[model samples]
Target: MQYKPLIMGILNVTPDSFSDGGQYCVQAEALAHAQRMVLEGADIIDIGGESTRPGSDPVSEGEQLARVIPVIQALRCHLPSNLLLSIDTTRSAVAEAAIVAGANVVNDVSAGTDDPRMFSVAARAGVPLVLMHMQGRPKNMQDNPGYRDVVEEVLTFLVERAEAAKDSGIRPENIIIDPGIGFGKRKEDNLRLIADLRRFVATGYKVLLGASRKKFMGAICGETRPVELMGATIATTVLGVSAGVSMFRVHDVKPNRQAADVTAAVLRT
Candidate 1:
């Protein structure tokens, strides 16, 4: 499962995802979309039950499991076996159930700090874990968020998290780090992240860049529509790719995949 600069497609199963709310909440539609992404060149399917966007409400454990389990099971049954599955949630219970249902990875936005058991879960399941850096809770992450030095702060947070995960039995190669562009950032901070992405990668973990229709993209393009953020998102992807990002968690699977192909052919040489 060595993903060297792979594209991890975003599949939000929640009813209110900012990117595509309720688009694939239904079991059949979710399966169809998952298959579509796979066909479009998604190396990994990252299924998320809870929306971690700014001002988002929390989904209960039962709702989270209900939203994610069926989709994971259906995809595992219908999609190719080699197609990787990454569950996005902070609850240990949900991660456990998703792994049992067929998730090969755990993508915790809280970076294993929220659920203490996530480290053990990844260890037991023997799967990769994505650690994302978020300053505060999702509800108020976008409100007056400030950092003395965004890059250094995020880098320190990720370093501490990686040490903790290693202490909890998660292997070094099995760990991935995400800068969390929109989770709690202003325009300048997000831009700084895009520019300093290589600094984070120098920390020695696979970097996963998740800039799919984020708020900063909207601010940059002067567009409120999430879909319109695609072009700016591509620009950031190009920058991140040049900075040596290991994987991408994105919504536009086809374009990102195509862009990644070009990037791999041209830049990563």
Candidate 2:
């Protein structure tokens, strides 16, 4: 059977996210945007409360719960049951609350390093967990990001994190690994990771690519605004599908869906 990558739409309820910040901060607006993504073929809607953009400060756990819980609850009631909802946060408390409120997945950018209880929370809920490889905290991740071999280091980090998640009682099948595209990577580092995505895919776990509308794309295409990088993002999506990525976390769903479907068709043929 040919594998078609799943598209996970990004819905950030934060007011300071590098892209689409404050656009869906309101509960009604967030729900409407999520519905639109679902109609556009998003298999999962990832709702993030805190801004993890470079140099961005972390939102407190209480604020994160306030920002994301209502949105998750509303989504569960309104969205189709088959469509999954992911809680994008590093705090175990926030992950736990979002799960109870109806999110089916936990996406931790810190990969359970920042919060000692994160793995346990995901295990307790028995939900799929996305562990990402970020070099440092978002506050300073981009300050001096350096790597001897970006692809090797990230792959090692992700494999180790996956092992940690399994040891913490998270089912191996329920774990997904993300390369953390712009979280702490140089432009070249981001390119290398995408180019070498097969290495990550070969780890025998699901691989997620989250390179949608990042600063590095803008750097590559000479576009300053995040929204203008959709074309660049689509290119990466095509590459990801060819590289056997299991999923894509993207801001624009429809175009990526079309791209992935076409890529999968070609691969099948």
Candidate 3:
């Protein structure tokens, strides 16, 4: 069987996220958006309550739980039983609460570094954990982001984090690594990662590529608005597919789905 990359639709239930923030803060709106993504062929729905964009202030744990739990609960009740739900959080407490509420995966951008307990939470839950590579905290990651050989540095960081997760009792099979495109990368760095994505894939862990409407697209295409970067996002999706990525985290699900399907078909030929 030809391997088809999975699509993880983004659901940001925060008022300050870089893209589509306040738009889905309401529980009903978030659920509705999730249902739409499911219909659009999303294999997973990633719910994030805090804004991780550069220079963003952190939200309290109480606020993060309040914002995401209700939506996860609602989606669990309304969506199919097999629809994978992923909680995008850096805090262990939030990840625990979300898993209890019905999330099956943890997408931590900090790769278990933000909160020491994050790895333990994933281990206890025995669920898939996405450990992404970011240069620094969201507040300062973009401040003159420097990387010596971006691809090598990111691959090294991901390997180290994956080993740490396994050492923390997280099953090796549950591990996924993401070369975070915009978290703390320059436009050239982002381009280099995408161009050299096969290196991350060769590490033998499932690789996730999240180039969805990021600032690099704006820097390259002169599309400042996040919404205006969908074309660029789709273009990167095609590149990622060719690079053997196992999944894509995207804001616009339908278009990316089509692109991934077509790319997968072409690659098969």
The true-versus-predicted C-alpha distance at residue 207 of model 2, in Å, is: 0.4
Each model's total of backbone clashes = 0, 0, 0
Candidate 2 residue-wise lDDT, 1-269, digit = tens: 65878999999999999989999998999999999999999999999999999999988999999999999999999999988999999999999999999999999999999998999999989999999999889999999999999999999999999999999999999999999999889999999999999999999999999999999889878899999899999999999999999999999999999999999999998
Candidate 1 local Cα displacement, residue 219, angstroms: 1.3
- The TM-scores of all predictions, comma-separated, are 0.97, 0.99, 0.98
lDDT, candidate 1, 11-107, per-residue tens: 9988888879889999999999888999999999999999887899888999998889999999999999999999999999999999999999899
Error of 2 at 103 (Å): 0.4
* Model 3 C-alpha lDDT per residue in residues 121-231, reported as the tens digit of each score: 999999999999999889999999998799999999999999999999999889999999998999999999999999999999999999999998898787789999999
To one decimal, what is the Cα RMSD in angstroms of model 1 from the true structure? 1.5
lDDT for 88 (candidate 2)? 97
**Clash pairs, model 3 backbone:** none
Q: Which pairs of residues clash in candidate 2, taking residues 3 or more apart in a chain or in different chains?
A: none
- True-structure RMSD, every candidate: 1.5, 0.7, 0.8
* lDDT, candidates in the order shown: 0.89, 0.94, 0.94
Q: Which segments of model 1 are wrong by more than 4 Å?
A: 1-4
TM-score of 2: 0.99
